[model samples]
Target chain A: MKTDWKFILQIFLSFLKIGPATFGGGYAMIPMIEREVVDKKKWIRNKDVTEIFAIAESVPGAIAINSATFIGYRLAGVRGAVAAMVGVLLPTFIIVVILSMLFLIVKDNPHIESAFIAIRATIVALIVYAAYKIGMTAVYDKTTLGIATVTTAILFFLHVHPVVVIISGIFTGMVAVQIKSWFGMSIKLEKDELNVVKKEKQVKEA
Target chain B: MDVLVELFLTFLMIGFVSFGGGYAMIPVIEIEVSNHGWMTTQEFTDVIAIAGMSPGPIATNSAIFVGYKTAELPGAIVSALAMVIPSLLIILIIATFFFRFNENKFVKSAFYGLRPIITGLIVYAAIKFAITNNVIGELSWHTASLMIIFGLSLFSLIKLRLHPLFVIALSGFVGMVLY
Candidate 1:
């Protein structure tokens, strides 16, 4: 595939333009990306956008960045992937760095300190809310509930590394499913179900 | 140079297991941040506030903030790249060979196990953060006000569905007024 500089530049600029709205990140950035990449640029079809999102969500890392790289790769291979990745990253990178600088400068101010006190409280709430949201989807069955409970217990009492816990989760999931199958039981991943529900809603809306 | 390498490697490790979105990565990031003695839990919460208010994924945003706090611009760049590099490589590999990686039964089972654990980790992250921030213990008017702020924040987020940025800004103003 002969990748033109102009095409790469277009990929970069399109993502860069979508970069600032990525404040909450993940799925929040999807509509905008779809607008720019599929609806506007016509670089890919609407159906391909759905496939990109499916893969992007399943993979590790931010969905926004993952989809960007996927879209770029589909269009122009490795170089296009790099172009899209850099493009999406650059705006937020600059903003965050500048914020870091500004934060360091005024952090010592008493008023700012007081404000941060409240902000910290809100941050905790945000995390709690995050857990609630994930829990709704992640903790559906008895086995899942057990996994979540044990994970918390291990974190609190055992003092193991979180990565260890995550790796354990992976292996545990695999083994658990295998055992369940031996008993002729089936496990349903809620995310797939969620996708189905979403598609149903989309169809209804259409 | 050694610090930069450590920063890169730390975030690279984080990037690999950072499933279930940026929030789920909080506990892992918190552990590394404290292990490196980069910041205190209180300070980490402040960093979270910054990351939450910023315009990107909290995982990468905090990585940039933590890296910058530790080793300046180079650190920020290295950490950011490290965080995303795994995503880039994994994505490319899947895009190339296993377009149906999501449909692989083994992969599906792995995620089946991973999902609840991700939820568990986030719950733990919340409790740990609250403990470190003194939200879980101690008693004072300060604590009382903080609780009120937290309650309101959670309400606004869940019930009202206000954007987090707006909630943060609102809480900051209330903090200034109260404190």
Candidate 2:
């Protein structure tokens, strides 16, 4: 592929367009990214989308920015990666910075503090809602449900590292798989209807 | 300068541990931010509310908010970079050698366990915040309004299929009106 500033700019602008719509997390933007890069711009093939998405998930940042960087690197090397990352995150960066400033100013006011009091309670509901959203996919079978229950109990009571809970969750999955196969149990772990590629398994894991 | 560096380092560590995604990072974030005295647990929940309402991954949004609260725009930039730089480096390295990394069983197994634990973690955060933030202590008429807002928020999110950002915005409006 030809490497040029214009091409990098195209990549950057394309991702900038995708960034704002990526609410709820980065993975939701995969189809949009795929359309822009593969169908529209022809920067990479359909297959590379899945590959980049997985690499994005396995890495440490927002999958949206990471995947944008991967596609950018594929096109124009390090400079392209930087451009795409900046483009993808720029909208969010601007919004959050502005909100932070506003929050600092308003948070101390009596009216706003009173509002936050209500917002705080509602936020608890939202957090529970998050757990409900994740639970639908995570609890596939009785075994997995047990794991979630135990993990919740241990986390609530012990206050140990979440890293341990995660590691143990994997071990529980492996053990459950082993038991099912060994005993010929018909139970199978079906993930949420979401495709693995766009989903966190390949997309949203932060 | 020191605050920016500390913010950078803290979020950098958080970035790696956030494999299960945004909500999964809340507990770890609570630990770090509270331990540093950067924010109280209740204030940390406020950050979550802001991050939830904003666009982007919650972790990244949290990084920006934490950065700004600690030291302004420069702090925001450094912490955001720290939160994401690890992903950039790791992905760049992988782009060179591994084409099909998720095929590994160990990684798969770890994620399998990770999913439920991630759910558990978020749930735990909810309960903890509920208690610490005084969601249930006094049970006054004021608390009733809070519970009503909670019901609406949950229903909008879980059943009505409202966008989270929209629900948050609406809740804020309602809070202003009622409280």
- Find the candidate with the highest TM-score and give its number: 1
Scored by Cα lDDT, where does model 2 land? 0.79
Candidate 1 TM-score over all chains jointly: 0.96
**Per-residue CA lDDT of candidate 2, range B139-164, in tens?**
88876777778888889888898987
Clashing pairs in 2: A169-B113, A170-B113, A200-A204, A206-B21
lDDT of residue A205 for candidate 2: 35
Candidate that would win on lDDT: 1
Instruction: Using DockQ, give the best candidate's number.
Output: 1
- Superposed Cα deviation of residue B160, candidate 1 (Å): 1.1
lDDT of each: 0.88, 0.79
lDDT (Cα, tens digit) per residue for candidate 1, span A141-172: 89999999999999999998999999888899
Model 1: per-residue Cα lDDT over B74-124, one tens digit each: 999999999999999999999889568777888888988999999999999
